[model samples]
Every structure is written in C-alpha cells, then in structure tokens.
Target: MTNEQKALITATVPVLKENGVLLTKHFYNRMFTHNPELKNMFNMGNQQSGRQQTALAMAVLAYAENIANPSVLIPVVDRIGQKHVSLDIRPEHYIIVGKHLIASIQEVLGDAATPEIVAAWTVAYNQLAGLMAGHETNLYEQQTHKTNGWTGWRPFKVGKKTPESAEITSFYLYPADGGKVAPHQPGQFISIRLFLPQLNLKQARQYSVSSTPGHEYYRISVKREKGANLDTNGMISNQLHDFINENDVVDLTAPAGNFTLAPDIDAPVTLISGGVGITPLLSMLNSLVENDYTHPITWLHGCRDQSVHAFRNQLNDIVKTKDNVKQHVFYNQVTDENREAGVLEGYLDISKVPSLNLQPNAHYFICGPSAFIQKQYHDLVGAGVNKQHIYFEEFGPQLLSLN
Candidate 1:
C-alpha cells in the first residue's frame, strides 16, 4: 500500500478501538446471511457469546496498527493459521470474508467511509488475506505430507465413550475408513464438527487430543458445559454428551495447534491445570511417561472436588508407580476424606508448594480458564521463571496476553 493508504489505516485506529466489535458483528451477520452454508465451519457457540466478534475486532485493530510492519504479528498469524487449518479454511473462503468485511466497514461507517478509505481498507484486507492464505497453504501441505495425514475433513466414528467424571466424558475416535490415523503432536487438538438439530446447522469445536500420540485412535475428553438457564454456551458440548453415541460418525479435521511439547527436551517439566483444562496437559504428561522421561515431572491440578476430577485413577497409578513424578491436588470444595487423601483446599498456588521443582531451566505448561491462565502466568513470571519457558493453552477465544 502507498504511504497515504497506510496512514489512512492508522487513522482508523481510534474508530476501531471505539466500535471495532460493532464492525465485526456487522460483518459476521452480513456474511452469514449471504453465505449461510459457511456456518458449518464456524463455532456458533463463540458467535453467540460474542467472543468471535471481539477477537476479530482486536485482530483487525492490531493489523491496522502494524500496517507498516505487519510481519511483527507473525506469531499471532501462525496461531490463527493453525486454527484455520483445523477448520479446513481455504483461500476462496477468505475472498468471501474480505468482501463482507469491507462492506460491513462501509455500512457501519456510513458516509464517513469515503472511496479512498474503503479502497485503503480493501488493499489492507487483501494483503492480510494473502499472508494468511500463504501460511495456511504451507500448514495444509505439512499435514498432507505427514504419514497417514490428509487435508480437509475426514469421517471418524466414536469407538468408545467412557465417563471420566460426572461432567467429563472421554470419546475414543477411530477413522471410519479403518485406515491408520496421523500421529498428532502431544498437546495438539482436532476439530470435531457435528450437526445441531435445534439450530439446523452444523457446528465445529476444537477439542484437545487427550491420549498420547502414535495411537490408532484419538481421544478427546469433553466437559458438558451446563451454562446458565437458557444459555447457548454449552449447546455443542451438551449435545455431544447427551446425543452422540458409540459408532456414530462425526467429521474431524486433521490435528493442528502450535502449543505442543518438545519430545526431546531434557529438563524438568511442570504441568498445571484447573477444572476441565487438564485434557491437553494430560496428553503431554502421558507422552512424557511413554517416552520414559527421566527428568523430574510435577503434576498440579485444581478442581471442585474428586468427583469432578477426571482421570483420577489413571493419574493415581502414575503417581504411585512413577518415582520421578509427583502430584498435588487442590479442591475448591474439600471434605474430610479429601483431607485424608492429601488434597489441598482452595485454588492452585505454586508458591504454596515448594515441590513443583521450579528450576530456572524447567519448562511450565498451563491450561485452564482465562482467569486461571492469567493468574498462573503472572505468578510464574513473578516467581522468576523465564517468560519464554512458560506456555499456556486457553479454551475459547485467544484473548489472553502472556506478555
């Protein structure tokens, strides 16, 4: 873009800050109305919660702010690229999105969206779209080239569904074609798409692969999200828990995520989780154990109580047999039995436990709610852990700022 175009984009920063969500909301509504079929590819739960709109708004604002050197956003781009690859997003889809986005900006801005302003945004959008398309193409290529890997969506059948907790169930998914499945990186996730009868449209959600890699089937532990009364936040999860059954087929996109454990790392590893966020971390832990990791490993988990803590027996077996592994459990609602079991009351505070082996060179992986992640990240940084060594995974929108 020309200097004037870049300046124009930068000038819209204030407006974007004030009404960015409004613009994105308009864009989504407009796009969905015109291209209803695309709804199958999006997380309607996020749309209803307004998370997708807010996330997109922030991304657009960031792009505009860094128009002169957008390469600085490569990390953010790569993260989004992984998500896009999992959703099977293609270049053609970006063209549709760009059209609706530019139209939404014009409509939201009214007469203020002059031809020059619209043209500038068009160029900016195209540039971003090109960058994203290129990155996603490479990601797709990587997936296809991997052994037993394929692009787009593949049919998978639920081979087994085991209740891990009162609210969480683990589904073992096997390829419907009876072919070998691609081995995913520990800590990665797969996109599962299902049709919702009430909404009359399909919805997709990314669930972390709970089991270790190199297995014929992938396992995803899902928590039935019973939201507030009449809330749609848990529709997909609720449907999966209530309706999905063994042998039922579902569409699954290939595994894609940047949050992965380096298998060759020979340092102390600490895994921390709160509530249902243990899914991905559990995969990392299992992988480490399978590889016979000799480094000190600490498992820290927090939940309401033992009843809601998934994988208790499995974790217990590991704790009992693995001398290199140590664990500490925190319960929000503890009982006398819990006290006898050595469970701590209240939230997880690493400072309170000195046995976590907080070595300066050790790596820390955290997964949980946004607030949980924020607190743990801040606490770890404050406790002298290097910012680069601490990685986190948060479900839903990517709004948290680790920096």
Candidate 2:
C-alpha cells in the first residue's frame, strides 16, 4: 500500500478497536442478506452467541493495528489459513466477505469514512486477503496431492456412535465413497457439515480427530454442548447428539490443522489437556502407543470428576503397558480414593508434578479451555520449558495471545 494509505489505516486503529464488533456484525448481516449461500459455510451457533462477531472484530482491529508490518501476523495468518482450508473456504467466499466488509465500514463509520479512508481500507483488505489466499493456496496444493487426500467436502457415513462419558460421545466415520482415507497428523481436525432442520440450513463445525491415524475410519469424539458457553452450546454438537444417528451421512472437508506432532523429532513429548480438550491430545497419545514409541511421554489431564473423564480406561491401559509412558490425573472434587490412588485435587498445576521434568529437547502440547491453556502455557514457561517448544490450540476462537 502507499505510505498515505498506511498512515490512514494506522490512524483509524482506535476507531476500529472501538467499533470492530459493530462493523463485523453488520458485515455478517449484510453478507448473509446478499449472499444467503454463505449460511451453509459458517457456524450459525457462533453467530447466535455473538462469538463470531467478537472474534472478527478483534481480527479486524488487529489487522488494522499492524497494517504497516504484517509479517508479525504471519503465524496467525497461517493458522487461519489452515482453518479456512478445513472449511473449504474458497477465493469466491473471500470476495463476498470483502465486499460486505468494505460496505460495513462505510455504513458503520458514516461521515468519518471519507473516500480516501475507504480506498485505504480497500487496499488494506486486499493486502491481507492476498497473504491469506497465498497461504491457503499452498496448503490446498499440499493437502490435495498427498496420498489419499481430497479437497472440498467429502461424504462420510457414521458407522457407529458410542458414548464415552456423561457428556462426550465418539463417532466412527467411514468415507461414503469407500475410498482410502489420508493418514493425518495427530492433533489435526476435520470440518464436518450437516443440515440443521431447525434453521433449515447447512452449517460446518470442526472436531478433532480423536483416534489414532492410519485406520480405515476417521474418529471424532464430540462432547455434546449445552449451557451458555458457545463451545458447549453449539448447534452442531446438539444436532449430532440429539438428531443425527448411526448410519447417518454427513459431509466433511479433509483433515486440516497446524497443531500436530512431529513423530520424527527425538525429543520427549508432554501432552496436557482439560475437559473435552483431551480429544486431540488423545490422538497424540494413541499415536504414541500405536507406534510403540520409546520416547519419554507424559500425559496430564484435569476434569470435574471420574465419571466425566472420557477414555479413562484407555489411558490406564497405556500406563500399564507403555514402559516409558507416565500418567497423572487431577480431579476438581477431591476424594479418598483419588488421594489413595494418586490422583491430585483441583487443576493440573504443572509445578506440583516434578515427574514431568524439563527435558532439554522436550516439546509440550496443550489443549483446553482458553483459561486452562493460558495458565498451563504460563506454568510451562515458568518451569524452564522453552516457549518455542510450547504449542497449543484452543477449542474456540483464540482469546489469548501466547506471545
């Protein structure tokens, strides 16, 4: 962009921050009204809960805040690119979003949005879109060419659905075409789209592949969401739990996510999770077990109680069989058996667990509630673990910045 445009964008950063949500909410409304087809591409549950608007607002403000030096946002951009690819978001969708976004700025900013300002924002939007499109294009090329990989949405049938815990259920999915499935890296997720009868529209949701890779079927463990939180009260989750059934078919994009394990890395690996965040970490742990890995691996988890702890026996079996694997469990409710059996009380306080010693070449992966991930990330850093080795993925829109 020109220097004048850059200066103008920087000058509007405060205004963007103040009215980001208002602008994005308006943008979504305008986009949906004009392009009703997008109703199939976005999570209507997030829209209802206002999470998407808030997240978009923050993203817009962040982009405007760093208009001069976008390189600093490359990591975030790559992360978003992975998600977009998972949802099969194409260049056309970006065009739709851009038009409405620019219009929303004009509408929300009103008299403050002069022609010069609009042109500058147009340049800024295109610049950011170009960066994201480039990253997504590369990702699409790499993924579609990989063995057994396919682009866009593929049909999958629910072979079986088994309840794992009080709130979580595991769904075993087999491709409807009966073709081979790609071996995805542990910790990656797949975007599943289904028709919502209530809204009479299609919506897509991302769920972590909770099973070990290399199997004929891809498994996703979904926790039925309810209550006020957007993560739990998701319409898709409710649809899966209450409406969908075995033998039901759903559409899904290929497995995609940047958060994954490097199986070839000789470093020790530590996996930590809270509540339903265990899904992806479970995939990692199962991969280790399936491969008979000899590396020192530690599994740490926290939940409300034993009844709510999904895969408790599966983890116990690993602890029993894997010589190099160590496990620790923390319960919110302290109990006599929990104490006698070595389970700790409250959250997984990393400082209390010395068994997870800071190995020089160890890598740490965490997934959980935003607050849980943040606290564990800080604790991991405080425990002498290198920040570079710490990797995390939140369940919902990212609310915390590790840097």
Off by over 4 Å in 2: 228-233
Measured with C-alpha atoms, the lDDT of residue 82 in candidate 2 is 90
Q: Which stretches of candidate 1 lie above 4 Å from their native place? A: 228-233
What TM-score, to 2 decimals, does candidate 1 have? 0.97
- Model 2 earns a TM-score of 0.95
Clashing pairs in 1: none
All models: lDDT? 0.92, 0.87
Q: TM-score for all predictions?
A: 0.97, 0.95
- Note the clash tally of each candidate: 0, 1
In the range 1-403, model 2's lDDT, one tens digit per residue, is: 9999999999998897788888888999999999898887787777887878988888888888888899989888988889899989888777878899989999999999999999999999998888889889999999878889889999999999999999999999999888878988999999988887768888888899998887488999888776754432377888899888898999988899989998686788999999999999999988887887888999999999988899999899989988999998999996897789889898889877766677745999999998899999998888778889999998666657786
Q: Per-residue error at 399 for model 1, in Å?
A: 1.1
